[model samples]
Target: MVPKQTAEIFQILSKGNFISSNGSQARLHDCISHDDNFRILKEYFAHIGYHLESGHNYYYFSQQDETNTNMEKKLEQFAHFIDVMDFFSCLDVKPVTGTRYRVTQIAEECFANERLRQKIFALSRKDKLIDKVIEVAGSLANGGFFEQEDEDTYKVMDAIHYLETIISLITIDDDGEQKNS
Candidate 1:
């Protein structure tokens, strides 16, 4: 494994983001997928207390447990993701991996639908409709789930499957009760 590539992968995963084969960072994804590279990286990252985890065509970091402050931040981020997912779901757009979405298209839908507009406004404090959409997309892009293809276009990366899978594991039971974590 090349030392530079190893360090690059470490920098990305260390941030709690994913390296995905179909993401904007295809070169880095290919680097990590090379022969013995994942193994080498797992051993390397283990020394720093982050377990290297792989999913589909992606890799990310995981810890056995987190500090309370870290846990709080993660929970808060997850809550925001839930709201984002809800907003997309309301558009009848399933949050499927590798899906491409347009900010202008979403904004148009929000303009036509009062409920969607309200949801978007609740998610962001932006005064303009377009700014709200941009803010939401920017958040997902920063998290590595979406990649901005252009100013108004974004493509969902394979890393999004991680978020979808986590959300799917949250089960609701009889009498509309959510399962205890």
Candidate 2:
């Protein structure tokens, strides 16, 4: 039999969301991370087409038979995430797990740095600096890489390692070619 929280786990991971060990859903993370739960959940989900996958302190679902359209859409979404990651990487506070960020604080930084301001402008079309920050941060939050602690503050989630892993796997050739290793 599956764990009691199986429904709750499915509710989140089925939608492509993650349960991060440090996020508000940490309890769910614990439920899934319990003894043998990973193997149990993986086998259970495999019967239903979703392959339960684990990452650095986080869990999500994947499908083996994704269509071409879905693959294309995912590639496009990953491209946007690359830009979003680039934007966050330039900040004084890196997006390590459990790191907290304030929109107003980031906006202030952008206001003080022309390079950051330009990067924000490139990422978002919002007229206000704060809104641009919000848009960028919201993208991460929506993707399950960050969790909003409050209206203005967001905390980085361990699921961010998913992005970091993917980015790290990519290699650039001497002639400017991008290769996946």
Candidate 3:
């Protein structure tokens, strides 16, 4: 039998929002990551024209489309979002999709590491280290790449659909050169 919150789960996934395993709310995290619950919900979701997608302790929605227009738009959006995700993924905290981070910690690192400082300084698009990091995180958040936990911390989200979309459009050469196909 399908578990409780079946409608709620469908609502969350249908909109392309992710239900992360490490979601800030413990109950929410547990609900989506439940082994049997997820499987049951996954089967239920298939009837509504969306496929339930699983990530590292997370879940999202996906739809099949063969048109290039929609695919290209998704790729364009994902590319920018991916760069921002990379910036956060580079942090020492190793923030999981639902982990919290503080601006002070990143700023402290900037002060100590010359490389990080230089990288911060080199960002002509941003002025301060915290802002630069926030800008990156915010961009990803806006693109649904990650979810904002608070003013400082950001939680990684289950946006792997974006990654899969981008990867499918890219081609690799024998020498390891990547090009858009």
Q: Top model by lDDT, which number? A: 2
Q: What is the full ranking by TM-score, best candidate first?
A: 2, 1, 3
Tell me the deviation in Å of residue 46 in model 1: 0.7
Off by over 4 Å in 2: 176-181
Q: How close to the true structure is residue 20 of candidate 2, measured as C-alpha lDDT? A: 95
Please identify which of the two predictions, 2 or 3, would achieve the higher lDDT against the true structure.
Answer: 2
lDDT of 3 by residue, 91-171 (tens): 687645445667668778777887766665654278677787677667656555567777877766656444545656776
Candidate 3 vs. truth: CA RMSD? 5.0
lDDT of 1 at 73: 88
Better of 1 and 3 by TM-score: 1
The TM-score, computed over Cα atoms with residue i paired to residue i, of candidate 2 is 0.94
| Candidate 1 wrong stretches, greater than 4 Å | 1-4, 176-181
**Cα RMSDs, all models:** 3.1, 2.8, 5.0
Candidate 1, residue 162: how far the Cα is off, in Å: 0.8
Q: How accurate locally is residue 172 in candidate 1, as Cα lDDT from 0 to 100?
A: 62
lDDT of 1 by residue, 92-164 (tens): 5665677778898999999999999999999999988999999998899888888889998888888988888
Best by TM-score: 2
lDDT of each: 0.86, 0.92, 0.65
In candidate 3, the residue pairs with backbone N, CA or C atoms under 3 Å apart (3 or more residues apart, or in different chains) clash, namely 97-155, 97-156
User: Which residue pairs come into collision in candidate 2?
Assistant: none
